[model samples]
Target: MCRTTVANPMMNEPWQRLPALSLKQLQYFVTLAQLRHFTDTASRLAISQPALSSALRQIETVLGVSWSTVPLRRSL
Candidate 1:
């Protein structure tokens, strides 16, 4: 019996250029989303609030998405 392997077509597309996201950055995003509080998220991640904010900004810039500016239920 012979087996065939399939390749992802999208990977060869020229327009598939996408920015990379770090694992740490992704973790920060998920934690912030779940906690809904910058201070709390920072504390949970063992980082300063400003550091967390900066990391989030970097992620936003890389993905070209605005999340911090979005209106959401959060506590300072």
Candidate 2:
């Protein structure tokens, strides 16, 4: 006979475990989320598009979620 143990099913306290983010990454995410345009977001951030893209990727990795994965509703 084989024995198995069930793991705990509890929500993680993200605030306690998550790493701190740099100001640049936070700015990049906010701009990208608002514009939904990489180029424009980069321009607004005064950085190259590739750099902005890299920053967004880093932030996504930290947050464990893609910016596009979150549903956003626009108001008229």
lDDT of 1 by residue, 18-72 (tens): 7888899989988988887889999999999999989988998998989857655
Q: List the residue pairs that clash in candidate 1.
A: none
Best by lDDT: 1
Give me candidate 1's TM-score against the actual structure: 0.69
Candidate 1, RMSD to the unseen true structure = 7.5
Give a tens-digit lDDT track for model 2, residues 1-76. 9989886555366665667788877777777778877888889888998887788788888888886877544657
In candidate 2, stretches whose alpha carbon ends up further than 4 angstroms from where it belongs are: 1-18, 68-76
Question: What overall lDDT, based on C-alpha atoms, would model 2 receive against the true structure?
Answer: 0.77
Backbone clash tally for model 2? 0
Best by TM-score: 1
RMSD (CA, angstroms), candidate 2: 5.9
What is the lDDT of every predicted structure here?
0.86, 0.77
